[model samples]
Target: SRAEQSRAEQSRAEQSRAEQSRAEQSRAEQSRAEQYLSKTNAQCLKGIFAIAVLCHHMYQYSGLFRGKFGIILQALGYLSVGIFFFFTGYGLIVSYQEKKEFYIKNFLRKRVLPFYLFYLFLTAIYALWRIVLNIEYTRRQLIQSIIFKDALAANSWYLQVIIVFYIFFWITAKVVKDTKKLVRMIIICSMLYCVGCFMLDVTSTRYESFLCIALGTMWAVNKKRVDKLLDIKGLQLFLLSIILFGVFCSTYIIVDNLAIQIFSKMASALAFSSMAIIFVFKLSGRAEVLINNPVTQWLGKYSLEIYVIQGIFLLLRKGTKLYIQNPYVFIVVCVIGTLLLAIVIKSVYDWIVRKCRPQVVNM
Candidate 1:
């Protein structure tokens, strides 16, 4: 009897060891899976960022189509902002995931400085245009416009919001390492937005919608929930397309009546952005074949510069009315002209960067 009891105890011990080994192996596999997902997440989002912005630009400037297509384009424009925010959050958090020690100078020099330089350059261009057109300009207005204060009035406030959000995100992310705290920060910003609405005396503009997006991005990145969405298939995409079209049509129908209402842009922005996130998840990996093409990827690299210059091109066209006989034709010419100019400028910029790199290394 004693021998039998000892044998049974030994059998139980062997079973326990096998279970432990299996559990460890499972954990190892999960870790590898998470690492792979993280990599794919970043790559997938980069293309989405490019496409979403492109969609928005097309809707805004290309009046080639009207009615349902127009509404769809406009909705896409809304979704583009959300896609950008998601990428921004995912990218920034992932970058800092390994290292928490913040370098203010490096961040400013690399990330923020280029934007300031571009802002100044663009502001100067606009100032020259205003002078040529003999449009009355106040010094204060010029300063505000350059710094993004007058963005609400300018109709191109996204740039201003981007600058502020980048800085805000960098600072908050650097200071608050805890994921839970980061989420709280987002909630706080959102609450402040609500309070600002109730007070009505608050000076912040609607362009500050970046706050919600920043929070959303931060939350999503830390949660590592991208895999939850990996199984989104074609049927899901088709359904999403239907829902997006439905909201877009309904919104358009009401837009004329709501022209004067404050929430028009905000509501549209929210609805479209939601649809965009869903659509982006469906479309992310599929674009790799196209975006991976050398020329396309090169264009994608310089796309942001193209985005900044597009408004200027439009302003020039509007002022000249050079192609106004047919708005559709004019839109086509404007797009082609912008792309050509963007390529030329990017080429020159790349050349300069390449030349300077060798000299800087020697120094």
Candidate 2:
């Protein structure tokens, strides 16, 4: 009887402790969801990936990487872009869902205008450089470059592609009253484009990139369900495999003979980006120190400026041979030079944002 009573007490105590632990875990999960819903870790992730892209560009010209190292660098650059494209879609919808009022004009004024201003600023800087050096760029050419957005930047199509996605998102969000349907529409559209790519010889990176974005938005839009799904051990492993497969797909050249060629399977890119976002969402708390470090925080804070500024400098590197010959020297010069310019550009951007629309600075 004494032994039985002791075991009974032990069971009750264990059950009570388990319940409390479950409650604490639930609270922690909710807190984490809120953080992922916000832009802090988003910025940190952006900063980290943008730096990867920056190095990819620098190495492209530096004669630094050869063989598999080169492939890895290329994959880093491309996959980083894939991650970015997904977040752009995910973040947009996440913000939109949080809003009481979805004002297109206000969104454009706040988000699109700042980007356009930065692009113009970059164009103006390039134009001034050409004029000062008497390198002979036509005004028409400059205007076209600014309008078309591929004249000088290392990865020129990114902004243009994203803007199109933004516009399409707004239009579709208006039509689809339900978030689920909106996500479905995007998936259908992506599938159609992929079909064209494989069957019609129409390979448009924009469509595929939009697919990645769509998947991201889908993840965010279906946050509650997906979060629960992510808790499943089997599902997590499956998603992880999908991500790896996607990375493998993104690495191979699609056009080569003996290549799998189904566009190196953009599906891989889509899966990898989607899983990566979920992974980051899950790990945001653990990486907070690196995420919130002063330099990294600054980098994360001003990632867009860094992205745009580095592209401009890399373009100059190509034209002016501003790059150093020695690998170490080149890396130091590029990394420091890019960061410094990015910092300066960010300050200028802040000033402009304050002067033009002080209200939007925080928004």
Candidate 3:
């Protein structure tokens, strides 16, 4: 009787252990699924960061929100741009992978042409604004603005950078057949671009986050390995990202040499983007609801428009009656006004495209 009781106890212990193991396995599977950055998730993040970029410009140009908070927000602006670059690189690779030959053939028409047209439209608007304001300029200056050699609006540098990168991406795709070699070439090109910017004495903002584009390409090309690293429990991954971000920030602060400092800043931006994505992935319950909602998705849809148009308001608010004295009211008006204008501009751009080239509508 004693031996039978002991055997029964042993069997119960083994059953409990097996149940625990199964539960752990299930949790791991769930975590793996949650860790994925879906298209919607990426768009949501772009939406959030787009707003951050707006606030960054608001604080920088308007001189609102002074002190530590202002400093933090200004710093976030570059990080926001870096995230955008990351998405650009990631999205290009993903699309190319999916439609290899088709994407390669139509890269310029599908990608570069639309952006260039929209940019030209925006530029014309800016030029009109100058005429209305009686800000005199020569014919040569006007020609330069139209040709993208100069800009009529603030924060127009980004448009040029995006156009160049698109061309670079298309060329690289054409020349490089191997995926690993393609990614390597992209990284090298990005590094050279940064160095050129530095040598030319371009503002740090123009080049600091360029590397993140390459980082995105690397992530997509080696997604299997990257996902393996990301396969830990959600909480663990979140904490690890936090630690890495901290290290990156510290590295930035401690570095004094100019070249090293520039590289460190780039590294910091990459870490910042990584941390943001990880935080979104690990978020649960109510917090998750806030991000994954329609409002953010809509913002993401018009993110580029919002980004390009906000500078107009920024310029308007300075030395004009349109300016709001109170920071709170100004922010609200800018956000609402910018969103309305962005929607209208995008709709008009879409209509023009449909009217001009009905056949390319699906593209």
Q: Which candidate has the highest TM-score of all? A: 3
lDDT of 3: 0.78
Model number with the top lDDT: 3
The CA lDDT of each predicted structure is 0.55, 0.68, 0.78
Model 3 agreement with the true structure over 153-259: per-residue lDDT tens digits? 65677887888899988898898877778889999989998999899988898899888899888878887666666656646766776787678667776877887
Root mean square deviation (Cα) for candidate 3: 4.6
Show pairs that collide, candidate 2.
246-268
Among residues 3 or more apart in sequence or in different chains, the pairs in candidate 1 whose N, CA or C atoms overlap within 3 Å are none
Worst 10 residues of 2 by lDDT: 315-324
Query: Candidate 3: minimum summed lDDT over ten consecutive residues — where?
Result: 354-363
**TM-score of every prediction relative to native:** 0.65, 0.80, 0.84
Question: Which of 1 and 3 is the better model by TM-score?
Answer: 3
lDDT of 1 by residue, 57-168 (tens): 6556655567877766655544555455545655565555555554433565556655655566567766776666555578888778766666412224656656676687
Model 1: CA > 4 A from native: 1-64, 103-105, 132-136, 151-156, 194-212, 229-296, 320-324, 344-363
Model 1 is weakest, by summed lDDT over 10 consecutive residues, at 258-267
